[model samples]
Target: MSIILFIILLLFLIGQQVFFEVFQILCYTDFRLIRNEESEMAFDGIVVANLAYELKEKLINGRISKIAQPETDELLLTVKSASGQYRLLISADASLPLLYLTDTNKPSPMTAPNFCMLLRKHISGGRIVDIYQPGLERIIHFKIEHLDELGDLCRKELIIEIMGKHSNIIFCSEDGKIIDSIKHVSAQMSSVREVLPGRDYFVPDTMSKADPLTVSFEEFSSHLTRKPMPVSKAIYTSFTGISPVTAEEICSLAEMDSSIAAKEYSEDLLLHLYTQFSIYLSAVKEHTFTPVIYFNGSEPKEFAALPLSHFSNYMPKEFSSISQVLETYYATRNQLTRIRQKSADLRHVVQTALERNRKKYDLQLRQLKDTESRDKYKVYGELINTYGYNVAPGEKKLEALNYYTNEIVSIPLDPVRTPQENAQRYFAKYNKQKRTFEALTVLCKETAEEISYLESVQTALDIALTENDLAEIKEELTNSGYIRRRYTKKKVKIKNKPLHYISSDGFHIYVGKNNLQNDQLTFHFAVGNDWWFHAKQAPGSHVIVRTNGAELPDTTFEEAARLAAYYSSMRGSDKVEIDYVEKKQVKKPGGGKPGFVVYYTNYSMVIDSNISQIRLCAD
Candidate 1:
């Protein structure tokens, strides 16, 4: 049992890992699709600048045709190309790097959101003049030439922030005076330029590095060891506009493990690493590399010229670029999301039921052990009562008794009790254990059956696809009175059925699943002249016979007993007593629970589930 439980827990943990991996992949894909990067690393300002240079030669006076907020921190600008015919969507979202042509609209607040209003006011009819980046920093500036209120041509700068966690849009005047920003930072918040009206705004100072796209082989190797770090860490931390993701990619191309220390490499190996790095930079500069690569898994282990890990089996052997990784990641994540959405509640219920059953079994185990010891006292008493006077006190210990034969030749007394007293004590113990055994027979059977029923319910819930299926189950619960219906003025009518069965005598019967159904079955649906049944002192279904004026046969009585057993927690047990009486004798309890009722002059019989012997009515 413990092993089984441990395996269950392990499976759950693995499931969680899979879910998270899928979620990460979806996030990456969404980001890439919205941002529109040719390659994974193209999300930053440097890559954008390279592309901007190409687009600028063709687009000098394109007008902004559309503006949208695809995400909270992202913007999409549809601009007419310089050719005056083609429309291009340039997206700038730091989280994603791929540009996509998506036809979706964002919902606006009753009052326009700050970013919406800012974009609407400044760039609604602005004409694009040029796009530029400040060096290779992760920032893009769009120069827009527009007509002012006086119809005079003016240039306004729109800064697209691409830095992680600080991505935003800032609209500035030609004089560099901050007009307003999508996100504002006061001087108190940061000593860097305050992005509010009247304050001068400038880009944050970024660290510089020899562009990996243009670094010499000697320069790359020397700069790498200047810091005592892992080669992966050194390249990522020292590079500007280069993400850790890109640095890891670089190491993969070099075929050197990122886990290894930079200083551990021999001179020959260092030369080889530098050569690989140089070749990767040249590939990017020449646009010779593919834009996308797919991994068996979502993450790309390789980048520009680096391997992200010493271990690589989980990595795909052939991803040409990072964009493909994003696509595959999202696809897998979407699948997981759908699966999780379908099974979330049922999974929780199964886990909860398993925990409940484990605890119940443990309790039963302890009780069984206790009962075993108590039963010995009963055996001892019975033996002594029959023949204690003829033997010595020590002679009739437990070892001397033959209980199976029901004979004791000579039984002795306990030193603490006289022979008569000892015999009576043992006899009393024996009788008590017999009674307890009878009661436990029922209790254990009921508990086990309940566990079984709950497990079946869980199974049913797991595969349920439509709301109607859930509604049907919920209807059963409501009829059983597990949940109460609210009284409304609209006079809602319930369209549920009573549980139907046919006795061996061919008499039809009905049972109620809940308190509401109980009342409806016993008082409204039941013929007062028929028989009714219920489990004494327990929660169970209300059972009724539809005999009209016919007398119920013994077989019918027992058939009803089986149903009483099945509906109660005692279902499937060896036996159960079902209290049956004329339906007329049944009366609703005053101020009692919905299904709670009282009955008089009832008969009872023990019966097993064997419901197959009883006929069931169709819907």
Candidate 2:
């Protein structure tokens, strides 16, 4: 029986396409999914609730010392308390709303926005007397105490609602009258509520879902059974603030198949589920947060405030605080999703330019091929000049000895013209063809180079992990005339830098992430003795190794080559050919594009595009 079970499991793994390291290998005794689908590292009620409790513990009486509106939908606040000064970031971006305590700061506009000015006026020096979440809904309410214009103590409410595209940050009076909001929703936009000034503040009804926190046993089972969907879907949809992943987790803890319909659940199954749900509900009431991030190999899969035993097949990494988990998960996810959204326009421009150049390059190559017969015209001219004098008048053909090939040749005669005129005509045709071939030779080379440069820009977009990287690529395109520059009063300073890696042998290797950075590293940062590595005949970053006048070990050389291969357009190949030479040997041509260089000689090696073994610099 054990051997038969092992065979079934092996077959399932092959069909799933997931690696053995992930949870796809995990199966129940009856072969049902413990969790049907893996969700994105989520920001749900559990995250918000855990965060509220953490804030309640840490920021009970913290005074708001400084406030700045960084993005239009975001705020950075500095709070000082008996504990220490901390920075909190709250963003209501429709696509990705988040609230977290951060250590970094963003640049604000020279002129404060209207909503920012209003917040400063009302709550600039307010003390956070209480921080709480009403239920499991994605909302946090801050009861702030401050002095009014007449120096009388007053109470105000600052609420942040993280409801995806409906997210908003609203300031309200003590009686729940809306004072102002960052994003206004009028009757025309949403029929549910109006969020303008003087309007009452209230959370939109969530399809009349029950609040899991205060629900009785009878309410839990009756509400869940009334739904006509899968048990997981019914659970989250029937309750406030609970997410689908959490619902599935509750079912897994109950040892029940979440794929089963809630309407089909028996009385005994309902009791088992309620027992599990109450256990987690009790944990929330007690404020027991065991935050952890689950990883599928090197990539983060999901995170939760409580331990998720259903994802036991995945690698769980526990963190000390929910703040740490939020920071780590979102930063990594932001690199994958947010940065792509931010750089979409830049990517579109690069893609359009690449398509145009590629078409032009293909057409030029075909035109260049038609000029191959130019040499044949030259041969015809020579043959006519050698033997046409002996041809009779109005003759059609002349058979003569061709000295070029040491063989007999037949030359056709235009009967209307003399032999000499025919030869001259052939010479003229040869000259025109020669001129076209010469012009096309140069044009093809230039067109090919333009295509290569555009491809390199495309690769840079894929490598970009932050806004700064996109800015550098955008600047390069503007200078190259691919994109028109947008006028802005403020000249935003770009602080883009190259990726630094430490070689296994302790040598420092720097890889440029974009064309401008590549130019800067190759021309200004690297010394004559430093070494440069690039993918041979490919569009790639310039990898510079700071040798410090010492000989590099073999390990360092291979690692540098791997960096070059990984950042290039040919990163998909099992092995990439790399060219490495001293920085002094690499030279930029006059009037060349950014990152375009010429090297006379170099050493070559074939290396794979794997740098997982390399250590990135802390900075």
lDDT of each: 0.62, 0.85
- Tens digit per residue, CA lDDT, model 2, 140-215: 9999999989999999999999877677899999999999999887775567888999998998784898889899
lDDT of 2 at 175: 97
Count of clashing pairs, candidate 2: 0
- RMSD of candidates 1 onward, in order: 18.9, 15.0
Clashes of each: 23, 0
lDDT of 2: 0.85
- lDDT by residue for model 1 (1-619), tens: 9978975776587787765665565576466556443233435433454444544654568788766665555566666765653333333445443332233344534665677677777777888877776655667677998877787888889877766434567888899988877666665444655677778877766555756665666777777878788888888776566666656666787788977777788878878777765665564455444333323222232332223333343333434433333334444444544554665654565557667876886687566556665666666666666546665554434335566675543444567667778768877766776677667766776566555545444433432334443454455445434447667789544466666777767899887654456678888988888888876554567788888798888888887877777677565567676788888998886654455577767777766754644556656
TM-score (all chains, Cα) for each model? 0.52, 0.59
TM-score of 1: 0.52
Instruction: Give me the runs in candidate 1 sitting further than 4 Å from their true place.
Output: 1-61, 68-76, 82-100, 109-111, 132-136, 174-177, 191-193, 206-210, 226-228, 288-358, 369-387, 390-619
Query: Candidate 1: minimum summed lDDT over ten consecutive residues — where?
Result: 296-305
